[model samples]
Target: MKEQSRRLGEDSIGSLMARLSIPAFIGMFVMGMYNIVDTIFVSYGVGPNGVAALSIAFPVQMILMAMAAMFGIGGASIISRSLGAGEQKTANTVFHQVIWLVIFSSLLIAILTFIFIDPLITMFGAPAEIHQMTKEFLEIILLGAVFQSFGMGMNNIVRSEGNAKTAMLTMIISAVINMILNPIFIMGLDMGVRGSALATLIAQAIGAAWLLFYFLSGKSTLSLKGFGLRIDVKLGLRIIAIGFPSFIMMASGSVVTIAVNWMLQIYGGTMAIAAFGVANRIASFAIMPINGVTQGMQPIVGFNYGSKQFGRVSHSVKLGMLVATILSLIAFAVAEIFPAELARIFSSDPVLIAESEEALRIMLLAAPTIGFQIVCGGLYQALGKARISFIISLMRQIICLVPLLLILPNFFGLSGVWYAFPIADFLAFSVCVVILSTTWRKVFRETEMVR
Candidate 1:
């Protein structure tokens, strides 16, 4: 673990990125497949209604992920920097507190979700026809909130300690398990939507167990010792403060999804809603590499910044941005050129494929520019500049996307919903450039002063 941590500071930027990101990319890429797998299986087994139910359920899942990211990303940032600064004790404490926090948050979310399942599904625009299925699916999934939150949140912590492979393995293990189980439960057992949810729940449990064993085995730089389930007010606040940006990013995504679903339901009905679901999943798959790259860059930037290696930090961000932009461009090309083909991967219904293809093209029109914005926001988060990160995150999802979703659909009708995506992407990308430029100067200037 010590050697792994040291490599983050000493390795060549390019090699380190490759070493870290390939595994991270594979992990995230597979993790993204988890959703795609479910979509495909459910769509085939239970039809478009199953897809719609999952779509409605997406926002709630996003909220769960947002909470996990708060502790995971937040705790990882502190731990990586603490390790860089040689504050082993601080890193350990944050790691331990993160575990307890995840448990508490997950339990709370499960209870709330159970209590409010009806309203939640209704708010997500689930038609009366699919409400029962959506509710059943979410109820089963929410029951495993502890596993989901702990597994995901701790994966980042594992990477922070320089165990990127282990972190990658955690996601891969869950995804693979879910992949194998989804068909059996959904098709073989004829369990339908509920089966898909069960597969995911079981997979998360195994992943969470995997993480627990690692930490307990004492192979990690940080362990669950001396600070078991004990929360220091100051440390807890710092963790939340640092992770707030990540939370906002994901939570805002949930909100935007709900708004989108409502708009689609109002204008287009079930077909529209299901079409948007297909497009959204494809978009998510396209963005996974960006997520992986950003995840890889996070520990590198946080560690080097803590150690005051401003040059390496700058180099890492630049490389990350370049790689991300290229990946986004590739995604844009694929979406533009083969939208229908891609949509067919999820469903065979002519209406579904045609509508999804159109939505995919229109929504992703400005996707080529998204790489810069995503990388820029992640840079701020890695440097512990949560305010800037939060703002950047907010701009793309809530501030820009939601309003566009509201106003554009009013004018263009269902097509306007598609327009909202690119319009928001373009506007948010411009704002990101401005903020990132200003932040870049301030960050480097502070480094010079310290030097």
Candidate 2:
């Protein structure tokens, strides 16, 4: 365990990043493929209505994930810094706290979802036509909420412990299981959108079991034995403080999605909503590699910062930004050149395909600058600067995108909905640059003075 922690401080930045980021990249990429493939299967089996239903139900899933991320990412930050400082007991307590947090939170969310399923879907801007389909998918997904929460939260804990390979395998196992079962459930049985939800639930359950075994079987650096179900009040609050930014980022994403759905409904109707769904899925897949890089950077930055290794922290941040920018550039080129071809992967409808193509091209115009903004946000979180991180999180979606979503559609119609994305991206990117520069200077000055 000590050796594993030591590697973050001692290893060459390039080699260490490659070791950490590749598995993370593969894991995230496969997970992204799982989403795309799920959509593809649904598009074929149930058509545009099915796609729109999934889109309406999506914000609920995001809320579930936001809760998981709050516990997972927040706990992982504390665990990484604790381990780096040679405080193994502190790390173990955090790990256990996160587990219980996920359970309680997941159950609360599930019960609330059950109570409000109808109104909730409607509130997310589900048209009357697809309301039932959206409700069916969301209810089944909520059934596995605990499992999904456990798996996602624990996966971040695993990565923080330097078990990146184990973390990678968890995602691969879940995604592969989902991909395999998607067709059998959807097509073989002709079950439609409900089947996709069921397949995802089963996969999440199995993945959570895998992570549980890793900890209980003595393979993990952090143990679950001594720490029962006892919740540490102070520590739990600390975890929430550190992780609040991630929750805001994800939860605000749900808000943005709801706003987008409402706008699409108003301006373009069901077909337009379906097209946005496809375009958004493709855009998400394109940025998965950048997300992977930031995930990889978190532990490295957290550990080094905790240990007072500012140089290593700086290097890791720079390398992460560089790699992410390169990946974003590649995604931009592909999005610009092959929007129509990419849209065709999900559906055969000519009108849907054309709408998706136009949406993709307009939405991703500022894709190249996005990687830097993402890495900058991750860097702040890794350093445990929650206030700044929270601001950065808000910059993109709430501070910039939400307003654009409101105003743009008033003038440009449905096309305005797409225009909101790139405009928000550019605005957010500018803010991140200013914040990162100022913070780095301040951080380095403090380090020099202390020395």
Candidate 3:
């Protein structure tokens, strides 16, 4: 098992991808399932409004996740390279400092959220019924914000330190807790939406504690050694810089979700909102396997780029693209074929199932391209091209997307809002092709210089 982690740098490109992607797929698949399980329970136990309320809360949840990705992806990129260069001490310092960042940030967010939960809910365009549900769920989950914040932020560090299995274990174990507690609390105790939120918070708290204990233990290679509470400005800056891409990517998602929910409320009503929620959740599962592939490739890309193995880095990029495209095509078919079954899995509510099928079919029209966009953007981050990744992220959500989201719905009404996603994704993939062409030119240039 230890031997698997050891060959990151020495392995052939094909072998490296397989070794990294398999664990990443399982871990990330489980990560997606974490919410999916909740969506099912909420849909069954609480009904379509419950699912809609959960959907409304997603943008806020994403905001916290954005912060985690900032520190997690940013710091991990540097740490992987540092480890590859045999600078274990520096890696340890970065890890400890990251822990401080995650805790402090979560505390600040929780205070602000608690102060204005109602106002924030209104801003997200929640109707009276959905607003009540959203408020209850957000309040419970926000109380334990630090657990999720630090857990997700630190999980990447464990993986970068050659502990992918441990990093994966964090989610796997949490998934179990979430799975068991959801049924007991929701049905056995009759807690409804609040019960679902409570179950998630409890599970995430355990994950956070697990990540913290692992670094403190002697068994880990990157133990936190008395890293002073003071933040190092230089280290902090680099972490932020490397992490900017991931922050932008997740932040854009939050923005898109808010925009969609607001529009659905304005033009489509509660039924439309429910439909959007189900369709989006299904799309999330489809896109994530490809994300897993990119995630596994990130450390490899960083390690090779750090070691100046330019050819190896290029090979990994191509491999990611191929895997992502193939997987996306397959998932597209599955979602399209089983739309009713998928909707039914989440909710038996007749109105939501009828309407959600519209949203699902519309959004998935260009689903195969999720593979192209994910692979393109993921490679940019893996190669330490943060700005490129940020722009690619924006292209789908902000630049091409928000405009179409606003304009299209006005002309075509409710269906128009859902249609905008696939259009924006297709356009972004074209731009990605151009950017990647330019990026490859630079890669070979640097490779020649090293030679």
Among the numbered candidates, top lDDT falls to: 2
Please give, for residues 290-336, the per-residue lDDT of candidate 1 as tens digits.
Answer: 98899999999999999988888989999999999999999999999
- Point out where model 1 deviates above 4 Å: 449-451
lDDT of 2 at 119: 87
Worst ten in a row by lDDT for model 3: 1-10
Better of 1 and 3 by TM-score: 1
Better of 2 and 3 by TM-score: 2
- TM-score per candidate, in order? 0.98, 0.98, 0.96
Clashing pairs in 1: none
The CA root-mean-square deviation of candidate 1, after full C-alpha superposition on the true structure, stands at 1.1
Q: What is the lDDT of residue 445 in candidate 1?
A: 78
Scored by Cα lDDT, where does model 2 land? 0.92
lDDT of 2 by residue, 1-451 (tens): 6566678778888887887899999999999999999999999999999999999999989988999999999999999988888889989989999999999999999999999889888899999999999988998999999999999999989888777888999999999999999999999999899999999999999999999988889878899878787989999998998889889988998999999999999999999999999999999999889988998899999888778888888889889999999999999999999999999999999999999999999999999999998898888888888898999999999999999999999999999999999999999999999998777787667667221
Name the candidate, 2 or 3, with the larger lDDT value. Answer: 2
Quantify how close model 2 is to the true structure by its C-alpha RMSD in Å.
1.1
Clashing pairs in 2: none
